[model samples]
Target chain A: MITIKDLRKTYDGFEALKGVSFSIREGEFYGLLGPNGAGKTTTISIMSSILKPDSGEVLLNGKNIYTHSDESKRIMGVVPQEIALYNELTAYENLTFWGGLYAVTPSELKARIDEVLKLFGLYERRNDKVTAYSGGMKRRINIAAALLHRPRILFMDEPTVGIDPQSRNLIFEVIEKLHNEGMTIVYTTHYMEEAERFCDRIGIIDNGQIIAEGTLDELKKNSHARETVVVNFNNLNDALLQKIHSFGSDFKQVDNMIYYYTNNLQTELSKIISQCNDAGGEIHNIEIRKVNLETVFLDLTGKQLRD
Target chain B: MIKLALKDLRLFVKDKRSMLITFAIPIALITLFALAFGGAGNSGKDAKISLQLSDLDHTEASASAIQIFDSLKNVNVLKVTLEQAQEKIKNGDEACVLIIQKGFSDSLTAGKELPLELQYDEAQEMQVGLLQQSLIPTVAMLPFNIGNAKAVMRNRFDNMVKGSDDSVHTQIHKESDGLFDALAMGVMQGSGTADIGAGFFGGDIKMTKLVAAKKDNTLGLVQAVAGTAVMMLLFSVVGIGVGLLDEKQEGTLKRLLYTPMNPINILLGKMLSANVISIFQLIIMFLFAAIAFGLDIYSHLTGLIITILATAYACSAFGVVLASFAKSRQQVQGLSTLIILVMSAIGGSMMPIFFMPSFMQKMAVLSVNYWSIQGFYDVFWRNLPATGGTFLSRIFVLILIGTLLNSLAVMMFKKNILKLS
Candidate 1:
């Protein structure tokens, strides 16, 4: 369990985090979702006690992490965005070194290294230097290194980025297993689908502030985001686009397809069809989709998840 | 092709490290070499061969010879007692000493062989050669300057003339006395050579050249091994220390800091590793020198071990300081190379300190290589005991230098590398 209270961080004259606070319960999968430069990594860095916030306190299981850093750090592990590993050393050597730093007994460190190596499916290449590993394999080893000491809480910052789909799936499976085994995890990323599928509670942060926080269904209901009606046009032009815009102001365009959001989808769809016919535009297909986290995020911040 | 070449030129100019290495290092080295080779003002006067003179004979003949030897150019004469001279030569302070025996004047007056002695260390063969060449002609002309050789020749000629009643023989003897006087005056006034001819004074003066005995005959080899070992150890430890920067660049240092340990432990660990490597490197270098060059390592084994440990610690600390001051691996490499080379040049690794200007010799104390090489010289060249005052002082200074540098490095490592402040 972790409690971050009124965390404020500044770099030069720019304020990176302004009174940002959040908490994670025991054995809960908490997601900090935001775009790049949206204070997610800064928050995770402060929570992990690597970066000191200007004015704040992070309590790990009711002890100040900054004051009792060694004790707090012993129960926590961080997987940074960068592949923080020594390429000249083998995976086994790197793991052993980290294990030693964590004060793991030598008798137990060996078994832990082998267990994590096999968990990441890198046991066959454990003897080879990390320079000879593939990008995905290196990413796996990066994640595997943090699990050597089996901390109570794990902080993963964008671990699945720039990896193959198979590797991503395997990482998610291991993380999910950890969570199911009552290990608390604080996962930070800009991927909406990962947050939706895996997070028990999601906090949508933007511009150093958490604007929305709840479960998936609770977020959709609280955000008041309407269902989206996707319409494809055979001959979309400027005139037809203007005619469709006149019907509803809440919409996004992608080439010939337009995503229109509204509560009264039937009336808006009929009116768009008649207007397209009159404007000499052909309708290709139309589909009505339920509101998801993407729509909820757009409704809350007026921007895409990646922006 | 021209565009490609221009692009490369642009890149090279943009890189400050490359530009510094290309232009700055050469300029610095040239300036150091010039200073060492007597390019600056009065450097020729400064670079003189030191000679020690011990006059056991208090006679006029020995004084005259010493005065002539002292008046030679490019030689500085120091009058010392025989005991002092022998001690200096034994401790490698003085290369050679010229000793005039007790009956030098008596032997020259009686027309017997001259008693002169040269006690020198064979290790400094070049200096001994200079001493011999300078003293040879001075010794050859000593008879004319002292004992009134012209008068002696005149009296002999007169006696011969009186014995032989022939007028032709008397006149010839008289003319020969006048010629001898003219030659003796010319040699005494130091105006020109007396035309004494080669091999004429070969037996007149008995110059005994004695070499001081030592356990090892190869002092030059010892100097080379010790100087090169210290200088190269500095370089090797610096390379090892720069691994800290490499770790910072690769992000592993941050990962290490994330563990449940004091951040200073990381720096201490790196320093320890560098020290270990430096010790091993020095041992290997000395072992090779002992096997190949016949260096006497067994005689002063304790002193050698102490010097090596202290030197390794100091050099390793120097490496850490360089790494702490630099922000990147490239910066560390460029800065360390320039600094180490300059230190080596001034600290008597590339050349002897006596060859450099007086100011540069004074500045050599600022270098870690200076202390390290001096410590090794104490063990191998001087053959001083490990517990001797001078040798122990050197070891103490090395340890003190290491402690100071380590403190500075720790402060900088926390503030700059770990961003603790």
Candidate 2:
């Protein structure tokens, strides 16, 4: 388990992270979600021991990692956003090299390398230079390198950005498998869908602070606009669409989907039907679904997940 | 640590630029020097000159002067008639002409001489001066020896008792031969004290002539080539280091740094790989020049090895420092080029320390290259002992550079990588 308290990182007079606090329980897969410049990278760097916090205490298993950096680093792993790989080296060679950085013996490293290689599906191209590997293959090796020592907790910042669907799925499967094997993970990403599907819990970070943190259902419950109801009418004209937009503030038309962000799905659905019924527009398919994280984010911050 | 070194070695070897800059170019340069430089030994085998005799004396005595040019080495004897010779002077066929006038022999026999016109192109004064200078020595030898011989023959005939043993000429020949042999042999015996390789023993090595000043002795040339080999070895090592920076910038270093091993191990591995590169470069350059130019590199192979070892350490350490300080591959290149150019310039790689200003020479002494070049000069050119104190001192300087630079590189890398400084 990792515990962060009163964590603050300041450069000059601008604060990157300000008095943030959080904890990741043992064996929990946690996602740190934020937009650009949300201090996700800075926070991760501090946890990885690559940067020191201005005022903070990070405890790993009841031990202050800052004070006992050497011992704390033994079980810690970090996979940076960038592909940290030597292009000239073969996949196996790169893993073996990374394996040596930890306390793994040569025999131990060989076994671990085989396991990770097989898991990442990089076994076939293990002997080929990394320069020849595709973007996804490189990303797999990057993650495999982080798990060389089988750390209790692995920190990966935006691990699946810019990967193809197949490779992305492979990565997602690997993460799920690791989580299932009781390896605690601190995964940071901007992909709302990935966070919604994968994370046991997530911290929605904004402007270097966690604006909200909870399980998927829990965060949605707090966000009053938890359900989105939408309907389309072929008879709806420009004036009527503008009049309907005034009735449902968050309603919008694009293609055939009318997006309605709402707190009460059934009540808002009835309101939409009665208002459009008098306006003489036909009601197309009308259905209700619970709001995901993006709605909670839009409700909380009035901004898109990507921005 | 060993893991890092192996990685560095493997990457460097796979890099084609490392092979090209460090090994191929140096070897090619050595081969060029060997094939281009013709051995400049003056054994009197190939010489050329021309002669124009006026024959004004129309006597055998004056004509005998013409025969002297034939005995000289490489003297192309062109016999030009007086009118032809005069016209040739304007056309510059010969550098100078020896015009023998009428009564020249009579004037000489009368113990006086006529002015022998030396007709040459007035516009080519320097050429005329060279021709005249050469003639002065040759003319002096002929007149002195022939006059002396003729006087002796005349005196012997005047004293001849009709046939007072006509073997007088034979007897006198034997006596003259004995005296000449005694004087020549005495001079030779006096000078025979010089050792065969005295110059190589750090004595008078320069057999430099008035002409061909740039043509160096075979030993000295070999030694200079050895110095060049050491210089380029440093460059190749730095090139290898720059390559390491490329890997680091590409994110390879960060991954490697997180290994369970000590960072020092990684640094040492890189240093060792760089050392290997430098050593390989030196070997190839030396071997190429040694084989192609007939250079005597083996004269002090052990000493050269020691020098190579020292220079390799220094250059490798330098490479580490460069790699550590650089943030990107381009920066690595800029910094290495700047440092190498400065080191090469100050280290007597481009010019011998002997020719540099004293201040510059003192500065060169502060560089690793100076010691390397000095070591090579001593061992290869001077053929000095490997255990000589000078060679040992050079090795010390190189080791010092290695130690200092290696430590500094480690510190810089740690600071920058940790983002502490």
Predicted model with the maximum lDDT: 1
Model 2 complex DockQ against the native? 0.26
The CAPRI category of model 2 is acceptable
The deviation in Å at residue B188 for candidate 1 is 11
lDDT against the true structure, per candidate, is 0.81, 0.70
lDDT value, candidate 1, whole model: 0.81
| Model 1 native-contact share | 0.74
For model 1, the superposed segments whose C-alpha errors exceed 4 Å read A224-248, A251-261, A264-291, A295-307, B1-16, B52-71, B78-212, B215-217
- Cα lDDT tens digits, model 1, A106-153, are 989999999988888889999999999988889999999898899899
Candidate 1 per-residue lDDT, tens place, B1-421, comes to 9999999999999999889889998898888778777885554556677788999999877888788777878677899999999877765567778888899888778645568787876655566776667667666666666664544454445655666667766676678678877765766777655346113443233333344245464657766987899889989999988999888887888788778888889899999999999999988998888888877787778998898999999999999989998888888888888899999989878776656666787788888877877777667656667887777878898999999999999999988743632
Lowest summed lDDT across 10 adjacent residues in model 1 chain B is found at B197-206
What lDDT score is found at residue B399 in candidate 2? 94
